[model samples]
Target: MQGSNWPIEPIPNEHDVYFRVHKNYIVNDGPYMFKPRAFVERGDKADQHKSMSTNWEEYSTPEQTQSEAKIPMDNGVVAMSVGGLRSENLTVNHAPIPTIRAHTDVNGLPDDIKDVEVRVKLFKHCRWVINPELSTNP
Candidate 1:
């Protein structure tokens, strides 16, 4: 309910892209090889670094999200198009931080079956933006 109070903003263009960071463990074989769980947020684990939130590419660049946002350098970034997600019935809203929320609801909660389907679509559509294994910083 944190974003519920925030003013609703314009959604990113369909052609626009967003970024998601994945830890080393999320990588199956290489940086390009990603696990579906990477796109799914688990309620059991807290995102202490993100303040229990996820940031989209519209608000920040992949490098900034990792460096400026204080995410670990060892993590890799995956890029997905706004249109692709929308096609899957997922909503991309820019509520100050630019978040990916469920199309049916506004809170962006990720515990339901719809969220699971969305995660799978994200996994299928995403491509490597920054390969952790090839990154000089990593």
Candidate 2:
């Protein structure tokens, strides 16, 4: 047979891929580990958080770049993607957390979501982060 070609692979989604990285905010936090600059601090036990986040350069959703503010009357903002949520890492100081979605519907939720988006806020930037800083010393 003559040389044959194959079609491009379909992008990862809820059906095939186990993880669903957003096209707008795919922040792989792997780089923030051992930068030669002041960004990273070395220690005897530097534990990798193993998150679906990005480095300092890429853009991230608001919740993906920073933790949500905890207060009585504050807007509920969660710092974890749906995937991080299933790992039982949601909420702080009690109460349900909110998710960054564009609409109230959950049809377009990313596969990264372990559970579901409580509130809907279109993820437009990178801000949420969970880089737990552990002390190397006793």
Candidate 3:
């Protein structure tokens, strides 16, 4: 018939498309490993006196960048290769030992923690890390 038309598919909603990524992509862990608490961030404390946080922003210098690249901290200041959302080649019961080193009271640091270096083991996949290094004061 002259009025006949071919069927057409509707365009997908861009917003809806993004939501499916989490369901489609699969992460394989066989040879990969890192610290258990590597991805954790310190919880924000609500100051009773101040209305809002008094945090200030600072740019990293060339020297600081070099130092940060070499060391990884449990406090999550500097960016390290260990704490990625996706780590491939990881096997169960085979967690790699991660070394953490930080300068004394630097990188948005509090007054308490100081210079430290440690090698810690992560048992399987866990939210919390169990290690002797965490017990000692830096």
Candidate 4:
């Protein structure tokens, strides 16, 4: 809670919360809502092996993440706890912004199907922390 704008060396604690900006990551149907691909890397050279960017809740407020960090707020934010992600064998690491990475097994190979499973688990553990439609005009 007392850090600078950028993420620091210490990994967030299990009880700590983080937020994922859901600009184009969400799906809305009739009465259902979910993230289509919440934690996948964007395949950009800069984000090749890292999960999508997330803000450490203790270090940043949702408003700051959206405004100061310049993360889009088209949909909203998904609040995820460190412990919750660990349950799915994922590790939350600190980059410029905190990122979620899957824990590799002995083989150290990336499995596409397993990645999908992890994304689903992450989606289930998340809850909306902001609603742009009601909280922002544009």
Identify the leading candidate in terms of TM-score: 4
Report every candidate's CA lDDT.
0.50, 0.24, 0.20, 0.51
Tens digit of per-residue lDDT, candidate 4, span 1-138: 322344245554464444544666556554445555555443244533545456666556555555543456454655677666766677665554223232111111144524666666766667666656444422
lDDT of 2 at 119: 20
Per-candidate alpha-carbon RMSD to the true structure: 6.9, 18.9, 21.4, 6.5
lDDT for predicted candidate 1 compared with the true structure: 0.50
Angstrom error at residue 50, model 4: 3.3
lDDT of 4 at 26: 56
Displacement of residue 102 (Cα, Å) in model 2 is 28
lDDT of model number 3: 0.20
Per-structure clash totals for the candidates: 0, 23, 8, 0
Local accuracy of candidate 1 as per-residue lDDT tens digits, 21-137? 656445547544666555544222443321113345544565654563356566676666666766766665553422333211122334553456655666666766666765453
State which candidate, 3 or 4, has the greater lDDT: 4
Instruction: List where candidate 4 sits over 4 angstroms from the true fold.
Output: 1-7, 12-17, 20-31, 38-48, 68-73, 97-114, 134-138
User: Any runs in candidate 3 off by more than 4 Å, and if so which?
Assistant: 1-30, 47-58, 61-138
Q: Rank the candidates by TM-score, best first.
A: 4, 1, 3, 2
- Largest lDDT belongs to which candidate? 4
As for candidate 4, its clashing pairs are none
Tens digits of per-residue lDDT for model 2, 1-138: 112222222221111101122222233346322111111111212323212322111123334323322321222122323333323332211111123211111123243434234222223121223322322211
